[model samples]
Target: MKKRYLASALVLFSIGSLFVGVSAISPLEVFDLTEDQLHILTASRFPRLISILLAGASISVCGLIMQQLTRNKFVSPTTAGTMDSARLGVLVSLMIFTSASPLQKMSIAFIFALLGTFVFMKILDRIKFKDVIFVPLVGLMFGNIISSITTFFAYKNDLIQNMSAWMQGDFSLIVSGRYELMYISIPVMILAYIFANKFTIAGMGEDFSTSLGLNYRTVVNLGLIIVAFVASSVLLTVGMIPFLGLIIPNIVSIYQGDHLKKNLPHTALLGALFVLVCDIIGRVVIYPYELPISLTVGVIGSGIFAYLLIRRKAYEV
Candidate 1:
């Protein structure tokens, strides 16, 4: 079964990741690890692995929820301006809240991401075309506008270097204390699983959900909140990871069907497994220097995105 293979792959790569670092440690010595090795495992390697899994799974689910709410399979946090808005929030936090805690910055980013997502939904409502591909392109343009603003401010304030750090997702700096914020996504994801049916119903349009006694706006707001929180947390914790959210859920839907409830587990597992594999490949591609997780995921996810577009066009014909 797909689940079995995914879980098995996740376990294998997870174990492999623990030993794939620049440090000279072996899985053979996992049991006999010296103090330094043990410290490396507990402090660095373990945190990086957890961060990767959490980032991958949470962002993918965020994409699924956004897709369901919008009735647009191509829509995602990446395409909806949510991540760009969050980055802008990070920029604000850096420029204004010089002494703000990381948590405080994430909170600001969450608010901005929520507003951006909500605005995108509003824009979607106004669009008459609503072509599958056109919607995400519009979102991309909207996101670019936000990103341009964020970058302009970064340049003006001479904080472009600080902003650049979050432009690409990386796990090389992950350590125990630094990665604890990612755990917040677990309970949020649990809530997502619980609301799966509601999300599915909401995708049917406002009148239908209302007839079914579901307050559509409330459900939509809840979905956006979950997405914004996940986007902001991951953006702050690991930087931008392009396409994990958009690609994973769509891949699950292709084989497993579009039911949000049924697809969450597969989406989460496949997303985690995908990111773990990408992380491994990035690590070893040019040993001693690691590629950012964004680059690898972007390259692969973009290829998949193109194939999906072509496949959708063919199906329409």
Candidate 2:
């Protein structure tokens, strides 16, 4: 399994590097580059590629951390109302701080994302559902409610057009200045790595982690903070890329085990690979035009999500 994963990682990385600027660089000319080609690669394609890779890997790792902290496989930013709440934060920023700087918008989005995630955790504590699958279902419903509210306000305030523009994730618009915010994921990812052992123990259940002399609540809060920060950064920089979080960790765990630290690197690699492949497909599927990353990931992820649902007859709570 390790060999297969390593091979898969190599293939995906090669493909990602190959297809990134295929339109401009011919297969034969890939070795011999002109100044223009070099410029395009360095200034445009490289930044966008790095952004997608980092965003994909970070969000996937964030999902893994969320699942471990919550002891639920199905929970993610999308399912747990974090993304919708973040979107709401963006919307509110547009309304109230129309002239706000990018940093200000990010701060607002981060706060709301954290608040929404905390709310979901509280709700999980209150609900006595026997099936763990049902937990995410309830979370999805809560997310929908939050999304509806955001949409309503956006529509009434004439900000829907702006909101719509940001609702879909696209790499075409990513240039040098535009994608720097995504680099925030680097520190958050490192923090996840640093606290990985705590997350693993926390996943065992609150009682066990507490008995082990770990402050379970503080660790869980720290994990959620990382999630919220990553979610907000991605949403601000490239719009919402759906299901990259939900799918990558689940896929990695099938091969690697549920240990957060053990699977983190694999999860990050696979997530970047998945997004790169999907982005390439989106670019080619429409020819000169392009499809949003959100759409490509959404379609593929929905299929995976359905399979997961059908495969599991019951979930351990």
Candidate 3:
């Protein structure tokens, strides 16, 4: 499994290294490159590729962390109300912090994302079913409630058009200045890797972790903080990218087993590959124009979601 993921990661990096822009210049051209080609690659294509890879890996790892903490394979920001809460936070920023800087708006979104995740955890604690399947359903319902409120406010303020622009994920807008915020996910992902053992222990149920002298609650809180930060960063940078989180982790665990440390690298690599493939497709499918990544991933991810639903026994983590 490790070899498989390493190979996939190499392939993804190689493909990304080769592909240059709408111009589609070759690597040989890159070595003997003209000034114009160098500028295009350095200023535009490189940054966009970096952003896509980071967003994919970060979000997928976030999902894996959320699943481990909750002991629910289905729980993720997309399914667990985190992204919706972040979106609501963005909307609130637009309303109250009308004159706020981008950093300020992202700060507001991060706060709401943390609160929403806390609320979802509380709901997870209270739920009777406590099954992996039930958790996401509850999360979906919770997200819908939050989404409805956001839509209402958007309509009332005549900002629905603006809100819609950001509601879907589009990689085309990711140039040098706009996509740097995604770098925030890198350190947060490193934090998750650092605390991987604690997360694994916490996933073994609270009582077992307590018996082993682990501060289960603190570990859980730390995990949630990482998840919230990654989700909000991605949401604010690329708009809401659905299903990359939920799907990538499950796929990784299929061959990697449930060990968080063992799976983290694979999850990150596969997540980046999956998103890059989707983004590349979105670019070519419509030619001169482009499809939003959210739409492209949504369609493919929905199919994967249904397959996971049908093959539930195969994904018991």
Root-mean-square deviation per candidate: 0.8, 2.3, 2.1
Candidate-wise lDDT, in order: 0.94, 0.86, 0.86
Candidate 1: list runs displaced more than 4 Å: none
**TM-score against native, each model:** 0.99, 0.93, 0.94
Question: Largest TM-score belongs to which candidate?
Answer: 1
In model 2, the clashing pairs are: none
Instruction: Estimate the TM-score for candidate 1.
Output: 0.99
The model with the greater lDDT, 1 or 2, is 1
TM-score of model number 2: 0.93
lDDT tens per residue, model 2, 21-59: 545676577689898887777777878888878888888
CA deviation > 4 Å runs, candidate 2: 3-23, 30-32, 314-317
lDDT of 2 at 30: 67
Kindly report which residue pairs in candidate 1 clash with one another: none
lDDT of 2: 0.86
- The candidate, 2 or 3, that scores higher on TM-score is 3
Cα lDDT tens digits, model 1, 95-130, are 999999989999999999999999999999999989
- Candidate 2: worst-modelled 10 consecutive residues by lDDT: 14-23
